[model samples]
Target: MEAPALEVVGLGKSFGSVRAVDDLSFRVEPGRVTGFLGPNGSGKTTTLRMLLGLVRPSDGRALVGGHAYAEHPVPGALVGAALEATGFHPGRTGAAHLAAYAPQVGVGRERCREVLEQVGLTAAADRKVGGYSLGMRQHLGLATALLADPPALVLDEPANGLDPEGIVWLRGFLRHLAAQGRTVLVSSHVLGEVQHTVDDVVVIARGSLVHASSLSELAATAGARTYVETPTPERLAELCAERGWTCAPTGAGHEVPDVPAAEVGAAAYAAGLELHQLATRGADLEDVFLRLTGAAA
Candidate 1:
């Protein structure tokens, strides 16, 4: 089956006097992982709910392959979602739980076993969900999402209760799903994990879109500042400012915005300023996330 793209256009939701999501718009292209991120109470959940048709939107639309989630003839075949790992019944065994939902998606019992094995949950197939570990429960959630072999996936914090090893496994699994040309959108507050897992990012705060861009672009934009250490800090700062560089004095050294280390070193040497250290203080995704979200607040 061909992979489907996800699009949310001017999506919004409100409850009484509060607006949970406001004019949010973003797209998740096929064959890549797009991370949905925000601070607590930032409407990430509300947005995802609207996307999956679990919540009625006050305005706009959420579409997969040019159709709303529930509009598809076989929505399960179009997209699979695991919004919460605790959705399973405690009394039901893992296999039994999946088997119960298989027919609803037009799959047979065999598909349950296949997904259980794929998620490494075969050994715990008959174990009650109440007896399962958090990681094990997360695995079961993933198995449920994979049951129909859908072309797209929507997961919310799939790594929340995972161990270090489980987190690693999930990263590879999501990447593999995207490699098969499936569109994947995962929401998580763990910016470090999302940094390595996703190809693109959509960040929201206080029910509004704050930023949306590819991971590389965000990193590059955040890392535009370089650090320079010189004995004549004030002199170097003046020199940089005269050259049209925005230079600021930092605790460790001087920060020159958008100036390369090579250029800084050459200019400092020409000005006879002894440099002790000069390097680029490259900003990672965490830096970008914090700055954007903090500003949004």
Candidate 2:
């Protein structure tokens, strides 16, 4: 099989006594959106920097399009990254910034215009970046990345400061890009937003990968179970306890562990108790994320 569009194998990095990334290994396939998720201080930014060749990996390697990004025949055309949109010169206009990078990467000015339009910044292309809001800066940054029409994209918190409309636009844009047979890796802390956008997810915690799988597989792994509610929570808890089941009391009910809905119904009927509510709670991406990352809600 052909090599993945982006692959990081046993990649490691450190600063002083801090191990920023530890033996990270993953592959981002072509024509898919892979969500890179982690809590704050989880080394995601560090890993993206290493992949883009801004920071050297202390050990192992990061490969883009079957080669190290620095060694690609046309690095900018092979991989485009938007780690920090606001890092550009404030004095330059959006169009100017993209034009400056175009030639260095052998891209033409027409390509720059096309990308600016693609990112919905054509109207404001001449506005100084300093006057741009965080959302506008993000669009400009994306425009720059698309100037080369690269086969892969690496984005860090690309939706950080976007409004609801901008967020919707970004999601559609990413899906469109992936449909064009490009690999898209987006890092975000907004699990709910990304859960509906990405095809797969790689979760990191404490600089280590805790989970990696397709969204459907993740949901299956963290499957839906029944939650029982009753006025007599204490009695329900006692019944569950005698049956070797775990139960936690809520305001007016007990969250029984891993029991079937029908079984719960039968149990309540046998006990001659009125069941106020019993429903199956579907496992969501956010729940899986929290469980894997050990993060508090």
Candidate 3:
């Protein structure tokens, strides 16, 4: 197997008295999209900063293809990252904006046009950034990241202002990058935002690693469940305890994992309890995400 495109080993960071990222470890392999997930202020940005060598880590290490990010002869060409999308000069045309960075990225001015087209921003290339819509600015940021055609990508909240249609376009674009064997790591606070686009997930909360696994593995771990909504939740709790079944309240309903709908209905009936609603459900991706991160709905 190929070596990981990105790796974090026991990574940690501190801002004086406060801890930011705590003992996190994960690997981003080539040819896949990895979702770096957590709620707001969960150290997602700090972790990314440390990985890019923008912030010094207090402990451990963050590596890009086996070396520290700054160790590469041309780091931008090895790993393209876009941590923010709004720092452009208001008066600069999008094409000129990329042209200024072309020399820094060791690419000629023509590369800017190619990336603008690659990110579907060719039509807007001549427009000043101040007049661009948020989604268009996002596309420009992506174009900038692709300036050198890097084999690895790290994007933070890349879909912040995208409309539904723009989001759909981005999904296809990121998938295309990964299909070409580039490693991709994207961060977001909402699981549903990038759920369909990612192949794996790494979740963190309060600066600590919570869960990290393949998306399919996480789904399989959640298993199947029967969702039941009844007024007498106390009685349903009893039935679950008696059956040695683990259960939890999933908003309006109680989800009994690994238990069939028939079993739950039969148990409620046998106990002479009233069930207003009962149905079989596959594990909900967002529900599992909330549980993994211990985040409130």
Candidate 4:
């Protein structure tokens, strides 16, 4: 069996009096897209830096493939990471920028061009880094990370500058990577996008692990929320008020907290109101994530 791709054991960091990351422990398994999530200032960047050996942890350790990153002879081949998209030299062309990192990972010029094409930047390979748009820089960052064809990937806010089309493309790309038995850990604030991308998640808040589980399990624990659509929304809302159930008007319906569809149907029937639609929504990752982080904060 293969080993866990990424491991964080009692990982922590501090800046003078401030503790950035507390005793955080989690695992990124092989062949899965795990989302590392938290609110702003949640120590996510610090944690990633520690994993990549860019920052020294105040205590604990981070490892890639069962060994400390520093212990790996060629860390780049074990894990490819991009914590930010701002490292390129302004004067270098995209292809040249990638070529610069190729030697560091034991690759060559052809491999650099291959990754440029893999990231769909081949056409603009000669464009100066300074003139590249934010989205293009993101692609270049990904290209640099993939230059070595590592088995694991760690990305932070990778979708930040991408357009809608780019976001869709990245979603498919990450999924393809995970499907190939590669591990992927991504941190992003775009909850909606993450919802569709990641298979599992490890959420942190205030430098502590808040929740870590499969996305399906997180959604399962959110319980159920029911939506009712009626021609007389005001009347139905009035009935809901009498029943002490919170009802908020939606686009063409009203969202009621934790009520079953049958109950909603019965209420409409009792009030002689015609029901247009009655549906129940399960808890989504975004709702659960916000609730967890908000409470922790």
Global lDDT scores for all candidate models:
0.88, 0.84, 0.89, 0.87
Tell me the spans in candidate 3 whose CA falls farther than 4 Å from its real position: 1-4, 227-258, 265-279, 295-297
User: Model 4, 184-294: lDDT tens per residue?
Assistant: 999976567777899998889999999999988888877778888887777987898888889988788888877887887787788788888888876665777789998
Score candidate 2 by TM-score against the native. 0.89
Find the number of clashing residue pairs for candidate 2: 0
Cα distance off (Å), candidate 3, residue 56: 1.1
Give the C-alpha miss distance for residue 235 in model 4, angstroms: 2.8
Residue lDDT tens for model 1, 1-297: 698888899999998889999999999999999999988789998898888889999999988888888988888767888888779899999999999889878999999999999999999999899999988888898898889999999998888899898899999999999998999999987688778899999999889999899988788777567788887788986897679888888897888877778888888888888889888877756877888988976
1 or 4, which is superior by TM-score? 4
Local lDDT at 12 for model 1: 93
Tell me which residue pairs clash in candidate 1.
none
- The TM-score values for the models, in the order shown, are 0.86, 0.89, 0.85, 0.95
How well does candidate 1 match the true structure, expressed as C-alpha RMSD? 3.0
Distance from true location, Cα of 122 in model 3, Å: 1.8
lDDT of 3: 0.89
> Which pairs clash in the backbone of model 4?
none
Which one is best on TM-score? 4
- Summarize candidate 3's per-residue lDDT along 237-277 as a digit string, tens digits: 99899999988998997989889899889988999989999
